[model samples]
Target: MTNNTQNGFFKLTKFEFTAIAIIMISPLLFSWSMYFQGLLIIVMLWIILGLSWNLMAGYTGQVSFGHAAFFGIGAYAAALPYFHWRISPWWGLITGPIVAVAFGYFLGKLVFKLKGPYFALGTLASGEILRIIFGEEELITNGHNGIFYMTTWTSKLPYFYIAAALAIFSILIIRKIIQSKLGFYFLSIREDQDAAEALGIDTVKYKNLSLAISAAMAGVAGAFYMIYMGFIDPEVVFALHNISIITILVGIIGGVGTIWGPAVGAIVMIFIQELFRSSLFGLGPEWLSRLHSLVFGALVVLIILYMAGGIVGDWPIIANKIKSWKNKTEGQS
Candidate 1:
């Protein structure tokens, strides 16, 4: 609506362009240090997950609380083939998304009839059911004992590059989607479903498509996650809590409807968590580790209360204030 054609990649605003440039050059700048590179990789993975969730809950207003279901399904889908059939991870990478998309399609169909909080609760329930199934299905999921991926000598560098590439690609895909015809439909549906339907938009079809895409992207992230951790368990893979935490944090902190907001939120939240873990744990404080969640929870509450628009949303207001001050100073001078 605002002539976004002029806002292409090369034409990005200064803030956006600078961020992209930094990401593009990070591998080269940090290649000498494995610690930084590893941190970057983990951050990239979170970015992928956050972006996937943002597409569904942020843009489409579907508010799915069960993304971990797709995440776990993809991890298992990839791991099962490698463990039992001796299939290459290359194949698993492709198949994982297919499986996740199919599952997500079914889930969207079942839950789209509900709205708002009920839909969120339904998805949460669905995720919990899947987690229980994975834990109890000993023959398939190894019954919480988990499977360990054989380690390789390629080190974490390759993984870092791969994760970074995937993050960038996923962002690009989301940007495209947000700018497309379908994005308008999504926005319409999010604002008012009945009004959107009155306009002849197929709300159900678009919602399902959004869910499918979100699940597929999440599945891709999960596939890489197994490779990165080299181990998987029902608790880590299928936990409903993890899904809610990541989704809510990313969406709230990043400015939910924006394309790159989730990536920004993921980087900030993960860095904060890492800093707390490192600094607090090194002090040998018993309660610090336990208090980490409390701290994060408090931060979330404050943000929701005082900064509901999130980091990106508040940024422009801050910038405008700064600019006003600068103009007044210049006039006085």
Candidate 2:
């Protein structure tokens, strides 16, 4: 994940740098289908969400079931300006994260007092409360009517590059954080909060910090979603299963604590999701599309049971198995 350096700060390894370079130039290197390009944007969006959830739950041990609240706030941050004042929604990119972070700070103050499932339920309720409040406030939010606008670009290329940049920025920021003293504090809190407190760490402050960062990342993704999709409703942005649950799955499937885990997870998740939704690119039976939810649920169960640490987390085990298979084939020959 990191290259050892004398100053105790980590740098990107050569392989990591090469992989990033390839990603940056991939669009230019090949003629990709428009569908593939759009899928790339979705993958980046999930990457941001995966990183967001991983920061709070994986690093800090504060599992949240309400990230949809922050995502909705971010989308509305952009949408409301356009809806109410005819202002450009682009401004929401700056304001969205700020608003989400403020909300996170307040929420953390209330929920951090509770621990374990109590905390999870508290956070979960926050998203549901927001959904109801937004849905009822037709005067301000237009209720279930939602907001709609035209996207700025006709081509997907611009959006693809923007999403890719955001994904890269998120990866670098997370990498830096995890390599710093702040990351150590987060790990300590996760391992044992009481012990961290006894060691003079400000557990509350660090936890809040983690939540704020997580919220900001999720908010940015929401802002981008609104800008790209050019439409939003309380249901679409705040859906517990779609936005919040998918974000959690992205993190858990990618390898919760590793740096590149979410990146890989996002890629796998988006492809599987799109493949199923498209019903094998329209070649499969219509029933396949309807079975996406069932298929995804089964996949998640299998991953959890067989690869508890996730793909990246359990890579060594996987590698050994592959090697064993190769050796057995050689012996048979």
Candidate 3:
């Protein structure tokens, strides 16, 4: 994620340099269909969400089940201004996360009191609570009817670059944090909170800090969603299974602790979903799109059974198996 930093210069390994170059040149590399480009844009958003979740769950060990709370809040933060006050949603880029962080701080104060699965349950409740509130608050939030705005651009090109830049920014910021002393503190808490506390690590403060940072980044993604999609609803933005669970899947599928794992996972998951939606590129029956959810469920079961640590987390085992297969073939010859 981050290489060694020189005097105010961000250094990169060869791989890092190559990855960035590829991302930068993607538009030029292919004349992609807008549908394909949109899918890629979705991948970028998921990467941002996945990385944010990883910071809390993978790194801080405070697994959250309610990140949708922040995402919805951020979207609404932008939507409300445009709906009622007539301010530009672009300002939500700044104000949205600010609002989400405030709510995150509030949520942290309540949830940080618990640990392990209880912490996750607290977050789940938080997401539900927010969903209900947003659904019922018709006067302010437009309730379940949702809010709409015209997107800033009709083409996906501008949106892709903006999302790519934000995704990179999120990754680099997290990389910087992960490389710092705060990263060590987060690791300690993930490993053992009591031991961290015994070492005077102030587990509560750092956990809250992690939640704040994580929630804020998610908020940024949500704000972008409102601007890009131009629509928001409690069911869409604050859905527990869709937003919260999918974000977790992205992290786990990609490799929870690795820097680029989510990016890889996002690409893999979306491609699979899109493939199913397109019914195996129109070879399968037309009902295939309706079965994407079932496919996702099956994928989770299969991945967990075969690779508990996830694809990136268990890459060594996979590589060894492939190597052994190649060796066996050579021996037979």
Please provide TM-scores, in order, for all candidate models, with all chains considered together.
0.90, 0.95, 0.95
Error at 14, model 3, angstroms: 1.8
**What tens digits encode model 3's per-residue C-alpha lDDT throughout 51-129?**
9999999999999999999998888888999999889998988988999999999999899999888999999999999
Off by over 4 Å in 3: 1-9, 29-32
- Relative to the true structure, how large is the alpha-carbon lDDT of every model? 0.80, 0.86, 0.88
For each of the candidates, the C-alpha root-mean-square deviation to the true structure, in angstroms, is: 3.0, 1.9, 2.0
* Best by the lDDT measure: 3
Candidate order (TM-score): 3, 2, 1
Q: Candidate 1 lDDT, tens digit per residue, 1-333?
A: 235643554356566567777887887787787777778888898888888888888889888788888888888878888777777654656877888898898888789989999999988888889889888988877878987887454577778777888888888788778877888888888888999999999999999999989999888888888878778887888887776567668778877888777887888777667667665637756555566556667777888887787777677776798999999999999
Residue 298, model 3, lDDT: 84
RMSD of 1: 3.0
Could you give me the TM-score of model 3 versus the true structure? 0.95
Which runs of model 2 end up more than 4 angstroms from their true locations? 2-11, 28-32
Query: What is the clash count for each candidate, in the order shown?
Result: 0, 0, 0
